[model samples]
Target: MTISAFQDYLNEHRDRLLADLVEACSIPSVSGQMDACEQMAAWVEARLQRLGASVTRWETEGGPPIIWGVLGEGSASILSYSHYDVQPADPLDLWQSPPFEPSVREGKLYARGVSDDKGDLMARIHAVEMYQALHGTLPLVFKFFVEGEEEVGSPHLAPVAQAHADELKSDGCLWEAGEVDEHGRYTMYLGVKGIQYLELRVRGADTDLHSAYAPMVINPAWRLVQALNTIKAPDDRITIDGFMEHVRPPTPAEEALVERIPFDGQALRSRWGLRSWLNDMDDREALRQFVFAPTCTICGLRSGFIDAGTKTVLPSQAFVKLDFRLVPDLTPELVVELLRAHLDRRGFHDIEIVPLSSLSSSKADPESPFVRKVIAVATEVYGHEPVVYPSHGGSGPMYPLASGLGMDSVTVGVGYTGSNLHAPNENIRLEDYFNNVLFLARLLQSYAGA
Candidate 1:
């Protein structure tokens, strides 16, 4: 089938497609909200059914449902993964419009989930429909694996993938999200880093103490600060004993790829309101560290007397949330073990380690057939050559379903650098949405022919 015919169909139904996306985004399917998540899943199930897909809704034990849909029939099949859940739109005052109320301004659609996953999900659906309408039948089988718990670290996806291995296997998988960089080059990622999110707690006195007792009382807040300092050094390197030994260095090929990546450090610094990157590294070093190095990040910290007013009370207990972004060979269990031992050796056994959630890192060969095909199709669609990343800095549940299954996955979506993902006024450009539909249509055709 001709690509223009598919593009024409999408153009003709552009209004309806936008309406569908707006409807999908209107549901505030925040990750932990059971009612909203269920409603969104039902809506997706019905929409898939209407598009002639045989849908199966798998109910999770404590998490939301996993909507699996299969459509068309052919020897070749493609698995597409997306999520219906969104990050909580907290600090609502920052939003110009209600987070659940979809609004478009200056050619961009704004909503909490508009850019993260819903936009990518709806664009793929529209592409499939457009392809079928133009060709009279789907060229290959297409599977939709939309989950409702991705925003919460996809806590249930690994087990679900194991249970449905036979059905979930595919020739290749298209990951949830991607973006066109500020330089107009579409970006594709082959894998993601791993995550170990945890918390450290310390308790001293039974209750808050007066300033007069500060010299006698062991302040938990001070203990937390000392413990945090031990994890990272002044040079911005992880100082957790034995933690760096597990971080697998990038291969020669991976290092070469990073060198070729177009990283505008000045632009990034300006956007972040920073004078320089970590350790005042240049573009090449900064990009290398970003893609290959594991990190110890302090996500949040809390204790008493954090309010606006000043109080002379000393906090009895203190806690801090930390996330360790792991590279290859560094598993979450290993991190926890290393951290516990490190703290014990430092005589900080009074501090407690609370492991929250984790996901292992995943990577795919950038030169694989499926990956090359995606790069080729993206080049043809976007005109400019696509910027390929061997692995993204962010972490996701890509390991269990993609790498663990011995299948390669690549990320492709309809977002731009300006898309305020996980923040207020999250949005995507209208033009990018249409372009992504066309890109997906062409990708389907190309993969089917191959």
Candidate 2:
């Protein structure tokens, strides 16, 4: 489609398109919320049906169901991976308006999942609709794997993927869309880092005791803190005992691709109200670390009397939640095993390790035909060379569907630096959203067109 025709289409259907997106985003389909998630599954299944695809709903072991749909037909197929579920809208007061209520202001749409997955999902569907309206039939077959548990680490996806590996097989997979950076340049990521989320707990006495007894009693909080201190140093390095041994280093090709990525560390630091990045690494080096380094981050810590007011009470129990970001060859199971051994060696075997969730990392070959075509098409459509990353710092369930099924994957999206994903006031530029729809439509046409 020509630029003029694209503009004309937008002019003719902008309001209705935005309305449809807003309607989908209005569903409180927060992941891990069983009741609301069930509602989202039903709505998503109906949406796919409306698109004229035969849909299948697979219920997760104990979470939301995975909605799979397929349409069009050809030897070449692209599996679209997206999530109907969203992160919980906590700290509600931080939002300018209600998160579920899509708010448009200053040429941006503010909603919880607008920039993350919903906008991308809707844009892809819009592209499908617009493509069919203009081209009659899709150039290649398309499969949809819109799951309802992506926001929660996709714990149940592995089982489903193993059970239906044949159905999910595809020529290439279109993972979630990547974001435009702070510089307003389009970006693409070939892979995502995996994650191992676990909690560490320590116990002292069975009940809380008076502070006066602190001299005689051992405080579980101190013990937990000490154990955590061993995991990371003040220099921000993940000193997890023997954990770094498993992280696979970047290949020469990966290094070359990563070097091309723009690094505006100062801009990011300014936006985050900071003076310097961790360890004061230069912007480029910090960017490399962000992508390549494995991390043992303490997400949360809780113990005694930690409230609005001060209370001198000895805690019986202490807990610290940690998330370990894994690169290639470093599975969640390995990290857990190493951590247990490390703690045991350090004489802290009493501390229990409770795993919450995990997803393993997978990367696509930069020179793959799929990656090359995506790069070429993105350049043609976006009017600029796209910045490519070998791996995104974020973790997702892409492994089960991408490389696990023997296909490469990439991200294409409408997010900008200020999208605030997983934070309050998440948003996407209205212009970017429309532009992505056009790009996706072009992408659909750029294939072999057999």
Per-model TM-score versus the true fold: 0.92, 0.90
**Candidate 1 regions with alpha-carbon error over 4 angstroms:** 90-94, 209-219, 303-315
Lowest lDDT 10-mer window, candidate 2?
1-10
lDDT for model 1 comes to 0.90
Stretches off by above 4 angstroms in model 2 are 1-8, 32-36, 90-98, 208-219, 305-315
Residue-level lDDT of model 2, residues 104-159, one tens digit each, is: 99999999999878998998888888777776778788888888877767778889
The candidate maximizing TM-score is 1
Relative to the true structure, candidate 2 reaches a TM of 0.90
Per-residue lDDT for 65 in model 1?
Answer: 94
lDDT of 1 by residue, 1-450 (tens): 676776778778888999999999999899999999999999999999988899999889998999999998789888999999999998899999999999999999999999889999999899888887777577789999999999888888999999999898888899988898887778888889999999999998899988679898899999999999999999998999999898887887677678778889898889889998778888888888878889999999998798898899889899999999999899999999999999999999999999999999998887778888888999898887788888999999998889888889999899999999999889999999999999998999898883
Each model's C-alpha lDDT? 0.90, 0.87
